[model samples]
Structure formats: structure tokens, C-alpha cells
Target: MLSSRHLIFMEVARLLSFTKASQTLFISQSAISKHIKSLEYFYKTGLFERHGNHISLTKTGQALYDKLLEASQLQESLHQEIQQLNETFRPPTKLAIGASTTISLYVLPSVLSAYLRQYPNLQINVLNRNSNNIQNALLAHEIDVGIVEGLTQVNTLTYTPFMTDDVLAVCSGKSPLRGRALVVADLPTIPVALRENGSGTLAVIDDELDKRGIPVASLPVLIRLGGTEALKNFVLADTCLAFLPKRAILKELAAGELVEVPIQDLTLQRTFYFIQRKGTESNQLVNTFIQFTKRHYSNRE
Candidate 1:
């Protein structure tokens, strides 16, 4: 890892404000000033020209900043590659991944099990969040790859389609709506269970319904929950209906515990995406995992 001071300097250069960098780095302004002074002393040149509260990088400082950014990326990449090599002799190749709730809960676990059967030395750490959170994690460089169901494209991240998932309106077996295809306008009459605001599933549901002139807010939401399992459990035990990914309710649907209520003249669907930082298209680990996921899904079809 680069020294804290160097990382701090990089933030300062990127943001062009020591105060802003200090807040981002979670350090006091005095500490940021001390680090900058130390760097300036070592280089025997002023890195920033200060006037009032604002600061700008000097000519020499600009060159140093550019070179620092290049060197840091190279160093990090080399470290990652070297670690991958080192881990081959040692067991359990470490991989960090992030995914939206539906993929993490329903889709990826089987793929992971199959992958581990093929490569027993692999070890993975998974972070589960909403699609928007997963995208933010990718941009923050906190995870190597993300699987998301984001309705909108983020320019800073690259998205590749991994699979298509349909969102189904589901209810418990005893509900009057069971097996009865519903008109779009009937959605507002039923008591509904919903995923929370940041949910990718919720976003798609709202967007599709909005296009049909029935806003999600117009629905009679009986409860709001964070995870699919919780919402599913509620639907299983109550008459309230939920819109969930079809993949998520396969077991329940098969067991006849839940019913897929088809909507009249409308379909709800979204793509599950493999996401990475925009410039990481060629990273070995990311490529390996994405290819594995795609091939795994294709084999099922």
C-alpha cells in the first residue's frame, strides 16, 4: 500500500483543495497541512500555491501529481498480480465481490458452489447491497466486481449483461388473487409488500408501472422491508402481494407455497449486470469471474 501521506497528496491533487481532501481522508486540516509541508520539504519545492483558503498545484507539483497517480496504479496492479501468484502455492485464492440482493440470495450461490467444485482453492468474500450501492462500491474501488440490476446506466462503471430476470407479482396460495391474472389497475386495490427505496427491484417496478400510468405510490403498500427473504416470508404468511424476481421464488412456486400472478397486458423484466470500474475491462480476476458467470448461466439454458 502507498504511504498514507502519498494517498493524501493524491486526494489533494485530484480535488484541488487540501481542506476537501482532509475531510475526504477523515483527518484534520492541520494534519493535512503537516503532510503537505513534509512532502514539500522532501522535494525542496512548493507543491501547492496558496491564496486565501483556496490552493492550486504549482508546475512542478502538477508533474509530480501526474507521475504519482501513474506510479500508484502500477504499484497496486503489480501487488495484486504478485499476490495472485503467491496464493497459487498457498491455498484459497482470495476474491472480493459485491452484488445486489436478488443475485446474492438466489442466482450466484449455485454458481459459486459449482465454481468452488472446479477450483477448490478459491475463496470469495461477498458484499450484498442494492444495485445503486453496488455501483458506488465499484467506483470507490472497494470490490473487484459487482452484479447489479440497476435500471439506469452509470457512465463511470462498465456493465455487461449476465442474465435476464423477470419480476413477478406473487402472493401466498390462499390469496384471492392467486392464479387470477390481474389487470394493471388492480395493483392499487391489493395490499402490497414492497422492497425499500434503494432496492433495484423496486426501481424497476416503479419505472415500469409509471410508464403504464400507474405509479407505485398509488399502490396500497402494507409493509416495507429490506431483503427479499423478509419480504417473501411476509408474502408467504399473509395475503399481501409482492413483486419479486422470478428466480427468487422458484422453490416457493414449485412447492405451491407462492403463486405467480400474471398481469394483464404487461410484463416486468430487468437485466442482471456484471459491473466493473470503467478502465478495468482487462483485469484477469474480473474477466475470469465474469466469464465463469456467463458460461455457467448459458449452460443452464
Candidate 2:
């Protein structure tokens, strides 16, 4: 358990504003000031130096803040572990997972269903967003785990390679691009449907094209869709080509509603990541689910 003064100091250090920290911690501003003063007096050092309306941590304060953060994390982890131990027979574990639109729509449902069958007591909640938003959520401590495409360079997060997926160029059967091998240069002339910003599929497509000295700005985008289903629907109804995850359009391809076209000089393969914050312990349920997903995909491959 953290002392109230220490917790208040931690919140103020993180927010950098006594008023904001007060509102966040549901304490009065005066109380926040008293706590800060107490901490500063005990250490005989100025924690925060005031400059107009802004406050910044001093060197000593920064060191203390780092120590406080580590202590708070350890306290939380200990509490969670004890709770897990208390409910030995049927532990109630809640996991909040963030995923990109493509993985959430096409890949996660069956995997989650199978996981639930094995651990029926675990409660799972999924938040579907774009890759960037998923990363943001993980950083903000809003989600326990994230599954995203492409590589992320957030130093605080640890990424494990979960699986690889291919993005295929697809169009309606009636479209002219169907039944043809299209080259990279040809993509600029065709009206393409694209996913919105922050989407993993869109990011990979843009990155791959850039590597080949082709700018995404060169492509004439006919439409921008928010979700995978919307993008597939746009391609199915219009004469526009879309780059989509192969898993997303499997049923459409099988039913002849959409046709896959090979793109020359492009192999849009992306590795999906299982991401979690570094130093965070994985609960038994999370560990089991991750293992199951790995085994299931490995057997399929």
C-alpha cells in the first residue's frame, strides 16, 4: 500500500499540475498542495519548481518519481497476484485486448471463442481500433494486451511475433483488374479503395510501395473505408481495386464475389504482434490464451 502523500505526489508528478492531479485523484487542490509540501519537507528538497502556471520536477524529484512509479507497479502486481491466488478454483480474470480492424474482424472471433471454451471463467473484452490507436491505448494503460500488424518502436512495450499475414489485391469479379497480374506501376492509374489512416493494412501497403520507390500519393484513391468490411463492400459494389488481408476476403473469394489479383514486385507480408507493457506479468489466463493461439496457428501453417 502506498502512502496517501506519496500517491498524491506521484499523480502530481505525472500530471505536472496540482489542479489536474486533484481532479484526477478526486482530492482538493489544497490537499494536493499539503501532500506535496509534506513530501518536500520530509526529503528537505524542492520537488517541483513553479513557473507561472506550469510546474516541473527537479532532479531529486525526478529520481523519487521514478522510484515511486516502480513501487506503485509492484504494489499493483502484488495485489493482482494475491487476488488470483485467492480464487484458486475459478479465478475471475478480466482481459481487455486492443486490436486493429482487420485482425478484430477476421481473425480474433474464432480464437476468442476457442479460448473461452477452455477458460470459461475468464471475462474478455475487446476494443477494436486502428494500429496507432491500439498502441495509444496500450500506453495509456487502457488495455492489457494488443494485437497489431507491422512493427512498432514503443520502447516501453514488448512485442512478440504471433503470426504472419499476407495482404492481397482484390476487386469485384466484374472489375477489369480481375484475372490479371498487375504491376506496381499499373497501380497508379487504377482507382483504388483504401483503408483510413492508422489502419495496419494501409500502413503495410504504403510502406511496401514506398520501398519500391512508389509513393502512395501517386495512387488515385477512389474511396477511403473505415473498416475491413466496408472496404470489401466498396470493392464488391464498385469497379475499384482494394488491397486487403487475404483472411478478410476468404469467403468472398470462395463465392466468386471477389477475385484476388497478384501484384508484381510486391509481397505484402506483415507479422502480427502480441504486445504488452514491459515488466508486466501475464496472468495464467493470458498465458494460456497466447499459447493456444500460437499452437492453433502453427498447426494450421
Q: Which residue pairs in candidate 2 have backbone atoms (N, alpha carbon, C) closer than 3 angstroms, thus clashing? A: none
lDDT of 1 at 103: 87
lDDT of 1 by residue, 45-95 (tens): 999998897788999889888788667656646755886878544323556
TM-score result, candidate 2: 0.73
Supply every candidate's count of residue pairs whose N, Cα or C atoms clash at under 3 angstroms. 0, 0
lDDT of each: 0.84, 0.84
Q: Residues 36-106, candidate 2, lDDT per residue (tens digit)?
A: 99999999999999999999999999999989867866665675677667856443456779998877887
Which residue pairs clash in candidate 1? none
TM-score of each: 0.72, 0.73
